[model samples]
Target: MKTELEKMLAGELYDASDDTLFAMRLKARQLFTAYNQLGFEGTAARHTLLKQLLGQCPDTIDIQGPFYCDYGCHISAGENLFINFNCIILDCAMVTIGSNVAIATGVQILTAHHPVLAAERIKGPELASPVTIGDNVWIGAGAIICPGVTIGDNTTIGAGSVVTRSIPANVVAAGNPCRVIRQL
Candidate 1:
């Protein structure tokens, strides 16, 4: 039988209240909480905390807290990643971000979702899908990247956009259900 964590990573429906998953989230919360409390001068300390939290932490990462994430270990970020303040990543599944990416404040990358049907929803099992962001991408402030969406390389997502589908590379996308505005 697959473990809850295994199920989650596989994009299958799983119980969120499982003990092991709960413990992992608790550990992530503790680490992020300390990371958020550190002063601006605590650069080394922040790096240490992020290294412990993320699945892949490059030496060139710069994430401004108060960052929030579920299962921080599911997040894999490449070099020169700069995530601004108040960002939330619900990494119930893998969130793979490529190099040279800048995520503005209040950006939400959500990989968790619930069943659409009321009967299944009431049963309390959750579904998840991975979100992949390619290299040289810039996500504007307050943009929400939904589950299973892939933003291609050299893309710019405009502020306050809600991305519900995959975005091709080298384009500017914005607005609700974010659409490609122009090629870059």
Candidate 2:
């Protein structure tokens, strides 16, 4: 079977990481800089570049400056998605964010995971799992979302939270390791 990383490189999966993924990543970053240097109204241009880099991107999307991604081909977002400044995504596997999502400043999403095996760890081969965020979710600033996490709709993740597990719908989650604090 084709690895997720391979699929990402092929533009099939929204997330995947492989040997050449870094090269593609650099290309996307270069394009980001190339377009970002154009100035403010360049939000449109930035979106254009992001659209090309990502596996998929909806029409209604806005991402501010200083956005970073390990592999844009592994990333995708739904409609009316608004991402603040300094967002980073390490999409080694598909990182899918649903419609009407609001991500605050300095949020990072990672879809890559490493094996616990010592020998495998030494090889430095990349492993990946998909991350699915449901619709109308609001992610706070400085949050780090880990691999294979599925966050349900209308959920709000607090600032500085580290999401290590899946979060169910219509709740408010926060803190390190990200637990559901209360219903939303």
RMSD of each: 0.5, 3.4
What TM-score goes with each of the models?
0.99, 0.87
Local distance difference test scores for all models: 0.98, 0.82
For model 2, state the Cα shift of residue 178 in Å: 0.5
Q: What are the per-model numbers of colliding residue pairs?
A: 0, 7
Can you give the lDDT of residue 163 in candidate 2? 96
Residue range 1-184, candidate 1, lDDT tens digits = 9999999999999999999999999999999999999998989999999999999999999999899999899999999999999999999999999999999999999999999999999999999999999999999999999999999999999999999999999999999989999998
Global lDDT of model 2: 0.82
Best by lDDT: 1
Across residues 1-184, which tens digit of lDDT does each residue of candidate 2 receive?
A: 8854565434343333354655777787887677557677766777788788778887798888778886677777899999999898887678999999999999989876666788867665556678899999999999999988999999999999999999999999999989999997
Please give the lDDT score at residue 102 for candidate 2.
97
Top TM-score model: 1
The runs of at least 3 residues in candidate 2 whose Cα sits more than 4 Å from the true structure, single-residue gaps closed, are 1-4, 7-19
